[model samples]
Target: MSATTYALGAFILLAYTLEAITGFGSIVIALSLGALLLPIDQLLPVLVPLNICMTGFLVSRHWRLIDRRLLLGMILPGMAIGTLAGYLLLPYLDEVSLKRGFGVLILWFAGRELWRLQRKAPAREHTPNWVMRLATTAAGICHGLFASGGPLLVFALATTTLDKARLRATLVSVWFSLNSLLTLAFLLDGRLVPALPQVLLYAPLLLVGVWLGERLHRRIDERHFRIAIYALLLITGTLLLVGP
Candidate 1:
């Protein structure tokens, strides 16, 4: 393999491990960093399926913790509609524009999250239902467009009543379902076949990431880990926005 391939594998391992711990952020982190090495179009097909594999495992293990009512009643419907709409529109979008726009979005999210963390603001008791609905729907559109919608969904869910375990379980379930849809879309559009080899090549790395992350999830301080993650994201967003 070339150096770029090795670098991408490292990024994949790091990203998925984080997701295993947090139940979200694999694609956003992986895609953002990987896009610096490879094109977004190529990376999404591979990253989405890998996400399915990881999240599928998580969902199966934590199915009992999922808030089914919230998922079905509010999150799923909005995301489903938005995802399909974004998928349909993907072919018309310009790749460079997409990358830069995604960078800006990530930057804003990371900066806001870091700011919140720095101030140690208490999470809100309730996010208005309409706001959550809008965020999830928007998250779906982002997933369809970039396969990196966890930030929005996470932001929306942070204010909810679910505790850490339940929230992580629910989020992974969301990724498993949405990414499956995205995988099918890729199959129908003739993109999956071409990406299969790369997907297969990285399977072991994904498993290792999950194993390590699950262990870390049990030991790490949540606040500090989050601070580190957003810090990395802040730098990544800067690179994506300015790098050639």
Candidate 2:
């Protein structure tokens, strides 16, 4: 496998494992490394379905913890609009610009989270509705355009005081719904449809990745090790932006 493919497969193994142990890490880790290793063109379709599949399992696995009303009220609708807009803008955005833009968002959000964790302060102590709306809209666009937007959405929602379990459920529900719809749009466009088979080819690897990530997450959670996954996200996003 190519270095890029190795990175992607390895990421799936580890990220999925963490999510299995602790739901919150699923989207955050999946998309962060995904943006770096896989070209967004290939990355979006491949990852989105797996995300929906994995996150859906998470929703079922943690059924009691999900916040249904929140998904209905904020994320779903925002994603609908965002995805539509993203599809419209897709032809106009070059890969480098899109990846770079995504990278910046990830890094910025990750930095903020790490800082709050340091100060022993609540990340969502006073986050506003506008922030959530902004996050959902932007994330929807990212997902529609790149099939990866977990870190941004997860970070935005993580502001709430919901416990880790609830946080994971909420994030999963939102992403699954939004990504499902985005996939539909991609089908309509006929651009990413051809890649579905390749996505399936990687399924087993993705599953393995999730399993590995779960193991890592368990160790980290047991030690109460919570660090921002965004530093890498930002750096990658910047790299994408400053591409050769």
Candidate 3:
């Protein structure tokens, strides 16, 4: 591997570890940083499938903890529509524009979450159902475009009734399903085969990340963890906005 490849591996491990702990950020974190090293188009084929593997493992183990009603009844329909639309539109979009737009969205959500955390504000008493629906659909579009929609989805879900465990499990399940669809899209469009070697090469790093993150997940304080995640997102968003 070249120096850049090694750097990407480090990013992959770090991102997947965070995802194992939180269940929704592997792609966003990895893609944001990795884009600095490689084109997002090349990265997406490898990263999206890798995410399916990581989230699939989490979903299998924690399947019982998922909120099936929310998954099947509310989230999937809107997200499915948005994902298809974004995927179909991707070829016409400018890469730099996509990254900048994504950066702005992440900045908004991360800034808001950090502020709320600082104030020690309580969770919202009621998030209108329509708002949540819109968030999920928008999240799917982001996912389809960049495979990095966790922050938006998380922003919406953080206001819901789910506790930490259920939230993590449910989010992982969502990723597993959405990423699987993305993988299929890549396969049909002839993107997956060329990326297969890179995917296999980095697979072991994901295992290491999952092990470490699972251990840390049990020991870390939730509040501190959120601070760390949001802080990272804030940095990532800024980098995406300013990076060449």
Candidate 4:
């Protein structure tokens, strides 16, 4: 195998491992880190299957813990509308510029998260339905464009609850639902068939990562891990914006 292929597998392993631990980070982390090895277009279509399989495993494992009300009432419609809108807009967009813009946006998001943590801001007792809807919409747009919308979705969910298991389960449920649609779209577009073999090659690594991640989940300090992730995302986003 080529070095790029090897690098891609490593990123997949890391991304899926993080997903297993946190519930919804595979795509975001992969897109951020894989930018160096491949363009966004090549990376996304190939990663779709991995995303679906890993997220499906998570959803099945945590089916009972998902917050169904939040899934149906807030996440579904907003993501549907936003994703559709983004898909419609894709043909007109300049891919390179859009990617660079997204990189900058990601950096800002990571910075804001770090600042929020630094300030030790009090968690809001209640997040309005409209706000949650809006956040989900933004997440859907990110998914439509880059297939990396977990952070926005997580922002919306973080406001709704603090229970880790519920958060992970609910987020997995959302990713599984969205990723299934994306998988179908890829299949319809003829993207999946060509990439299936590559995806299969990485499947074992994805599974192993998930297994290892589940083991680490109990031992790691979530808060510290999250902070470290955000910091890493900031650096990765900056690299994306700067280019090689």
Q: Residues 1-244, candidate 2: write the lDDT tens digits.
A: 5777777777776666665655545544666677666666666666667767777766777778888787789777877787778878888988777766766666676677667666777445656899889988887787666555665677667766677667767777776677677677668877567878867766786567556655664465532344634455556556655765
Cα-based RMSD of the predictions, in order? 0.9, 3.1, 1.3, 1.5
- What candidate 3 gets wrong by more than 4 Å, as runs, is none
lDDT of 1 at 205: 95
Candidate 3 achieves a global lDDT of 0.88
lDDT of 1: 0.91
Better of 1 and 4 by TM-score: 1
Model 2 spans > 4 angstroms off: 1-3, 18-38, 209-219, 222-228
Where is the poorest 10-residue window by lDDT in model 1?
Answer: 120-129
lDDT of 1 by residue, 102-188 (tens): 898799899999999899888777888999999999988998899888888888888788887898899899999999999999999
lDDT of 3 by residue, 99-143 (tens): 888788778877898899899888776778899899889988988
Cα error, residue 98 of model 2, in Å, equals 1.1
TM-score of each: 0.98, 0.80, 0.95, 0.94
- The model with the greatest TM-score is 1
